[model samples]
Target: MDRLIDAIERTQNPSVVGLDPTEALVPAQVVASFADEVRDSVDTPEEAPAAQLAVAFYEFNRTIIDAVAGIVPAVKPQIAMYEALGPAGIDVYTMTCEYAAEQGLYVLADVKRGDIGSTAAAYAHMLTGVNAGASAEAGSAGAGAHDPWHVDAVTVNPYLGTDGITPFVDAAKTADKDLFVLVRTSNPSSSELQMLDLADGSKVYEHVADLVERWGADTIGEHGYSRVGAVVGATHPQEGRALRERMPRTFFLVPGYGAQGGTAADVRGMFDANGSGAIVNSSRGIIGAWRTSGRYRKDMSADDALALVFDTAREAATAMRDDLRAVL
Candidate 1:
């Protein structure tokens, strides 16, 4: 946790590249490259589109990862996007996670997977390599007994309370992994439940944030960041500040910047006095830049699109870092 936090601080940026691919938002070149392969193998257009999109999506993700690995501290691949496409999609998701790790980038599997007891354990194992299935040299003597295909961390939902979070806690402690539990989300509709005030005057999410702080205490690292963290959307600046104060040692994963109407200023409060406690994520704004009509594509080739997106994202992230530094 300390190393990761140090990296973020040194970079002076918290932007985490998010791989949340949607078929419609993919570039024409990506779609075209795999269309023929999918067309020949599948019987229906719907199936063919998904098949082609999944292939292109993973390749695009690799390209983006290659472009931004050194600039960003982490990459969050949203699981729902891959799961929506089926088994082939899952293969791509696993490959992307492994590839990200190989590139020396921290992978935060944005699964938000939650359950109780045994089922939760299964989810923990799947995300963090606790009971990792197999290694390349699994049967070889002295070939390393434990599989190391684990992610640096994973995002989880805390709706079910402590029981729902114990497995993740165990996984983090046992494997030196990390967890980012959702306290307040960025979506417009999250307020429907999160903002509801209880009879005691505290909001539902306030209660959640309080528990997250306590849960993370046991996992606090030398740098003052806990292995257990919280996901607070950048969209709610005031609420994010409140949550930051409530969970001083908890690392924060802030989503909703860029395309979600959150500017660099919106997330500044989540950081500690040293500017090292949060990671801001932007998905569509960074990955789907090619879809911005013809303006951004005027002089750029498909191969250069990812690079251009990375350049723009890096600039935005840098500006945010500067903004925070000025305040801190």
Candidate 2:
């Protein structure tokens, strides 16, 4: 956790580039490149199209990783997008993660998996190699013994409370991995449940935040960020600030910074005194920037499209840091 925090501080940017590859948003050239291979392999035209889409998606992610690997502290790969494609999809996901790690970029598996006991352990092993298992060994070998998955951390859901989180906690400690527990999400509908008043007058999310802080105490890292971190959405600046105060030592994995109503000002509250402690993630806004109406167009050449996207994302993150610097 300290290493990651140090990396972010050194870069002076908390931006976390999200690898959220969607089939429709991929560059036409990428799709064209795979069309012939897909068409030759599959029987039906429909299957051919699907195969082409998958290939394009993977290539798009690889390009994005290559573009921003050194500019950002981390890359978050949303697992749901990959899982929706099946085994071949998972293969791409694994490869992309390994590739990101090879570039010395921290990979956070944004798999909001939540279950009790052994099932949770399985998820932890899959994401961070926190457990001792054959899959872990295979992963370690595949990433190269020295590479070892290259994942520094993972994001988790805490709806099941301590039981769901304990396995992840144990595994992260054993493997030097880190866990970011979802507390207050950035979604518009999150308040329906998270903001509900408890019997003791505190909101439900408040209790969850307290638990997250306590759980993180045992895993505090040298840079003051904890191996056990919390996910507080950037959409709610006031709430984010309150949560930051409550969990001073916990690293924050903040989503919703782009394509989800969060702006540079909205996320400013996440930083600590030293302008550390938080990583702002932007998914569709970064990876799918080319599809955002007039902002960027799908018809642009892949190189030009990607260059524009990288510049935009880099500028957005730089602006946020600059704003924080002004305030501090």
Tell me each candidate's TM-score: 0.86, 0.87
lDDT of all predictions: 0.78, 0.76
* Tens digits of per-residue lDDT for model 2, 1-328: 8767877876666778788887666767667777778788776676676677677777787777776766777889887887787755777777888888888888888888888766776666653443345545432211222333456677888889987888778767776778899889999999999989999998989899999888888888788777888899989999999988988988888899868988777877888877788888888766765555366765677667656655655555455555545654
Off by over 4 Å in 1: 37-46, 130-149, 293-328
Clashes of 1: 0
Instruction: Mark the regions of model 2 whose C-alpha exceeds 4 Å error after superposition.
Output: 41-46, 127-150, 292-328
| lDDT (Cα, tens digit) per residue for candidate 1, span 226-271 | 8889999999999998888888989899999888988778888887
Q: Note each model's CA RMSD in angstroms.
A: 4.2, 3.6
Worst 10 residues of 1 by lDDT: 136-145
